[model samples]
Target: MSGVARQIDRPRRWLVVLVVAVILFAGAVVAPSTGITRMGPFGLFAWASWLHVFGYAFLSLTLVYALLVSPDGPALSAAIVPIIVVAYGTSLELLQLLIPYRSFAVGDIFADGLGTVVVVGVWTYGQAAFAALGFRGS
Candidate 1:
């Protein structure tokens, strides 16, 4: 592919990934809960909490990748991506309040924010570390 085509392609691919993440997030949050209250030896709540954490983490990572691959990507993406992801999570939680089978939970929002922060922090640190080691990428 030509340079221009490659550049456009990269952002498009990340955008597709971001869209898929959003769809999965929506489905998870909006779907009615299964009556099964236990998984293996663990309570369903425990698994759900971890799911919220990891799901938002994955969502935020995709957002960062999408922004970074864009032609006009921001220099402060590490700082911005978490805020965006957390906000999205919060909005989804609020949305759950209206669903008959789903209810909003502040704990879920906290978990989502925690996941976003942890992932972004590690990503930013890793980038800085790589730059310091003279292995920076364009």
Candidate 2:
């Protein structure tokens, strides 16, 4: 790697750190009755499942970006992002079990993991294509 390239990668290290922090915070957030937990602005808990899928998709995409930026940020393993996302989703569901109105559901976990898998697959193929085209700086 060129020295200039290495210098440019330094800033990305902080970006990866920020992304990891966001993922952790998002995973631990309490499920709200409306807003992000729901679909529309007025509807309450309407189409909540699709919200979970959407939220997790963004989270997964952020995680994939972090992995692509820095493979050795703390203990973050690119290969384990999907597993971690699924585990985080499972933990969220478990937390919901204690809430008064929230009910734990396996479907949420599936949706979250599905999001992670889709992002990971896309990132993997993107990197592969980049490499094939001689673009090595991820």
RMSD of each: 3.1, 5.1
1-138: candidate 2 lDDT, tens digit per residue: 676876677677657646754664454465554554545545544466666666677777766665556533324556787886787778878877877767788877877777778877887788779989999653
Off by over 4 Å in 1: 35-45, 69-75
- Cα error of candidate 2 at position 92, Å: 0.8
Determine which window of 10 residues in candidate 2 has minimal summed lDDT.
Answer: 68-77
Mind giving the per-residue lDDT tens digits that candidate 1 earns over 8-101? Answer: 8877867776686777567656665674223423544666677778888888787777766444544456889888888888888887888888
Q: Best-fitting candidate, measured by TM-score?
A: 1
Best by lDDT: 1
